[model samples]
Target chain A: GESVGLHLPTLSVQEGDNSIINCAYSNSASDYFIWYKQESGKGPQFIIDIRSNMDKRQGQRVTVLLNKTVKHLSLQIAATQPGDSAVYFCAENRNFNKFYFGSGTKLNVKP
Target chain B: GAGVSQTPSNKVTEKGKYVELRCDPISGHTALYWYRQSLGQGPEFLIYFQGTGAADDSGLPNDRFFAVRPEGSVSTLKIQRTERGDSAVYLCASSPLAGTDTQYFGPGTRLTVL
Candidate 1:
């Protein structure tokens, strides 16, 4: 079945440095994409989202980039903080029905 | 404004037992969704409701799993004859509307089937 997947399982970055997590999705029909952050024992928290019509979207210290042609998505966190340590997931939505999530990438910010 | 909320943050059940997980979505949101997250994996779609009717349920694994939103504000996910594989974090989310809306998630209900 077509699904969303991440390029790496874990990413470690030093505090105050930039961090980028990558994801790959197989469904071309997907038009909306979102990035979520989940800490231990917590549900996913919405970070940022982007539409297929746009290539990039930015929020507070976070940016989401989408490449429809390559079926790729990326989340960039500026000046990574220790509080940013968590599992990040990318979700793709098609036709506003359901969203498929990737396995997730664990971001470890070293203090 | 309150965010999504799920009851009984954690549950432990034996095999073949029945369990129900509840979700209270954000006020005035018409779209609700449920997902299951297993260990080392992201959340997997289970079902979605547009108002009081199920708009999509293709993600449900089998017949034993069912969900309902009677008044379109709250939803309950029922699992009959639960199996060990059913153990996971059940997450509920809600969006203001269907198309291009961002979903806000609950704290989740972690169910452990032994």
Candidate 2:
């Protein structure tokens, strides 16, 4: 079956250190992608997004990199904070309707 | 004035029982979507609505699940004969327009079938 997956299931980083979470998607037909963060008991919150035409997009403290050639997507957080510790997911949209999700990477920021 | 809102923060039902979850989207948002998230996994798309009509329902697992949006605003997802496997968090999201619009998500309803 077609799917998206994360390279690391869990990652721990020191506060103020940078963090990078990687995802690999098998669907080349997907054109739109979004990143979301979810707390333990909450719904996924919108973080950032990138289109297939572009390779990168940045938000307040997060950056999304899309590698079309390798079918890879990554989310980078600058100066990781305790608030940034959450499960990060990469979702790809087809025809802008259905969104296929990666398993997700759990981020843990240690002080 | 608010983000998405879902009713019944938590639900506990026995196996083979029925459950209904509701979602209230943001004002002026025409696109609505439903997704299911299991423990340690990201959300999986279950369905999407464009206005009062369901535009894509292919993500639904089986005929046991159904949803409706008669007025294109509030939506309800109903599951019949829920099993233990149905235990998960049901998430609702809404977008202003179609095609890749930024989605605002609700806190979600946690359904537990035992």
Candidate 2's residue-wise lDDT over B29-67, tens digit each? 999999999998889999999999999999899999999
Encode model 1's per-residue lDDT on A1-111: one tens digit a residue: 888999999999999999999999988999999999999999999999998999999999999999889999999999999999999999999757788889999999999
Name the regions of candidate 1 deviating beyond 4 angstroms: none
Q: Global lDDT of each model? A: 0.95, 0.94
**Which residue pairs collide in model 1, if any?**
none
CAPRI docking class of candidate 1: high
The alpha-carbon lDDT assigned to residue A86 of candidate 1 equals: 99
In model 1, chain B matches the true chain B with a TM-score of 0.98
Reference-based TM-score of each model: 0.98, 0.97
Specify the CAPRI tier of model 2. Answer: high
Q: Kindly report which residue stretches of model 2 are placed more than 4 angstroms away from their true locations once superposed.
A: none
Candidate 1, residues B1-114: lDDT per residue as tens digits? 899999989999999999999999999999999999999999998999999999989999999999999999999999999999999999999999976799999999999999
Candidate 1 reaches a DockQ of 0.85
lDDT of 2 at B22: 98
